[model samples]
Target: MKQVTEKFRFGIDIGGTGIKAGVVSTENQILGQAYVPTGAERSWQEVVPDIVHAAEEALKDAGEFMENCISVGIGCPGTIDAQTGTVVYSNNLNWQNVPLAQELHRTFTQPVFISNDANCAALGEVCAGAAKGFQNVFMLTLGTGVGSGIIINGRIFEGGGPGGAEFGHTLLVEDGELCTCGRRGCLESYASATALIRQAKRTAKQAPNSLLCTLCKGDLSRMDGRIPFQAARQGDEAGQRVIREYIKHLAAGIANAVNIFRPQAVLLSGGISKEGTYLTDPLTALVAEEVFGKKNSFLPQIRAAELGNTAGMIGAANLSQ
Candidate 1:
């Protein structure tokens, strides 16, 4: 087996709108990278060629040949059969049972490993980011939707079959908000950046004279997740309310995960995590309060993700290890 620090790997991250590829040292350093639009509306067969092209471009940027890399690893959004290297379902890409790894392997002529994008992010963080020293970690990305990944004993934990770690889809409130997954009151419906933006818009409408309204120029279209946090910092009542509620909901979701997994660390990623201590400080306190065994057992450390967008590619590259 090749040592993690001694080899290069080709990594690809497949998203709804774009595909990002990187030539990453197994130790988590990115030597070169490339990006291309996903064109998800097209067929999976059409997209596979672009995926290969992106990898070729990244290798070119790194001034390396494809044969130099030990393997090709991919982080894709959707239900994946990792053992078979298949994408079973991907609503974002409109794909079903696509043999992703098989297609890429034919071009790269090497081992190909595939996993959910969020799972890859978690592994990347464990390899070289926020959860570097920990063996058990749970990560939640509060983006357009809440993306989650679980790592147990330094390996991605995918419950049992075709990608079962759907932490974002976990129930939060009973019949409260409709989620993108056609469910009601999911964690994503409450704790995501989209949910935060929606909360800010609601606050703006109810309190037209509040700082939130002023910040958005009285046009709700301009409201975003940051406006609430920004308003809270400036001592705005409505902004503070929005952030407070957002934290409460997010804490509930984090607390639920902690109670179940008892990971050593829980990381926050995506745009909302930029709030830093403003988000983590209060959220950690609330999660501690709500999690089971608060009085007698240890609680996980909740912190912001360090890698941002690069975590997925880096984690993907390390999958072969």
Candidate 2:
């Protein structure tokens, strides 16, 4: 028999402001990485070249060549027709019905695969991150908007179609705050970092003399997600209220998911998860109270994601497996 050599893979994570690519070994470790600005305002044709460049840079960093790569996987923001490897729509990138996998396949001999960015994150955790040993997991990424990923039986649960598991858009409150999805009271509207900033700003405007307002130097526009947590730690009543309410809403959304999926673990990612115990402690307590039959059933462990932004890239790379 002719001797065979093991090959590496490429994973690309496409975001609104930037793109990331990594060279992944068979052991699931990232050997090298490259990043480039997405410049999402342009058309897909203009961005595709950059995506290819990112992969080239990563391959170079890994001291590997395209001939050695077995496949390429991409995690993109949008509704993806995974079977066809096409992007159905992406509000962040303003792309519609683009043949992404086919386009990438043209640049390299390796086969290409694509999936939703959130789903990729969940898959990454299952592969080597926080949910490494768990078969059932749920993940929430709290950034400009809320992103969610679900895993069941050690596989990505994309629902009936490629882009179906949209937990962020699940309605949490009726006739409440308007969401970016143009809906009222979505979990994203109440639990995202954007929503936290909005709540902090409103609270600051009401209590101008509070520490929360002082943190922004009396300019409400300067308020960000951190300001509320900062003010709360300083024993500022206004900031405390914002944190308390944010936690309550987030817990409600999480508990709702728990009731349905009952996963083994729920991981929190994105910039908000940096709060560590400050965020998870209260969330766990509140979710425990709301979950059905909590006294009789074991509640899922709530944890911060270990891989951070790399989860999407790692997960995307493994999609071909």
Candidate 3:
């Protein structure tokens, strides 16, 4: 006769480029992890199988089989009908009406939960990261595009529907840069990491004497956002000018959020967030300068997200509960 092993939860993060999964415990520790390319190029058809493989590997890494698992949760980009576990749409994977929850349940016979990736990260931060002690957290991911998630009272506070907090779409300017959503001057257009790179390239082309010209090796499209930040650290004049405007737009967006939610903490995550203190410290200074108050009364204490890339998976696992 053999004794039963304790059950464990599984969390999965699905992105445009890859899939991340982890085995989590009741205490929120990630006991194991697995990764694989999303294979989105193969069409949404083959992508489903890729998800199953990733999940199986994570379970194997934990030395636990599916039968011993308690529940599973997935965090994905797009609108989700959380109650029905349906993915309304996803631009990265080009999936629509994806019955993600039912597919996982049929394959693994485990309870399944589905949520937007941003919401998952907000949940993860509340449960395990910078916002661990705070009752309210607002997370902004400034990557190829801007993604936002808000947590209130320890839950993903989608006011009514999935459209609850599309903060990135808030109009920053009218008729600005063209956006994939067919909008102009969306927050994502002016402040996303990708947007910064595009702006940097345009600047470098005009300011050929700047360091960006050398860093890009004359291939303007190759410029990285870090180049300008690095040059700024060196006191380069062009870098300073470029960064100043970047910070202005970013600060404006954040300041507006503060006026709305008055969250306990604002966590920033994603590639550009690595600018670290360079961005955080100055951002704090700038937001304070523009936030319409004297004592930092209107702005939240901004902090970098502690969970990093794993936030998505950690949040996914939490959704199962």
CA lDDT of each prediction against the hidden true structure: 0.90, 0.90, 0.82
Poorly placed runs, candidate 2 (over 4 Å): 1-6
Clashing pairs in 1: none
Clashes of 1: 0
Candidate 1 lDDT by residue in tens digits, 1-321 = 122333689878999999999999867789889999999999999999999999989887777766678989899998989899999998899999999988887787789999999999999999999999899999998998898989999999877898589999999999989999999999999999999999899988999999988999868999988899999999999999999999999999999999899999999999889999999999988988898887367899999999988999988987863
- Go through the candidates in order and give the C-alpha RMSD of each one to the true structure: 2.8, 2.8, 2.5
Alpha-carbon TM-score of each model against the true structure: 0.95, 0.95, 0.92
Task: Give the 10-residue window scoring lowest on summed lDDT in candidate 1.
Answer: 1-10
Summarize candidate 2's per-residue lDDT along 197-255 as a digit string, tens digits: 99999888889899999999967888888889989988999999999999999999999
> Model 3: per-residue lDDT, tens digit, 1-321?
123345777889999889998988767788778999998777665787778899888877777767767778899998888888888888888888888887776687878998889989988888888889887888899988888988877788765776567888888878988876789998888888888888888888888988866777888877888988887788877777778878888888888887787788888888778888888898888888776574547567888899988888888887853
Q: Is candidate 1 or candidate 3 better by lDDT?
A: 1
Off by over 4 Å in 3: 1-5, 43-45, 65-68, 292-298
Higher lDDT: candidate 2 or 3? 2
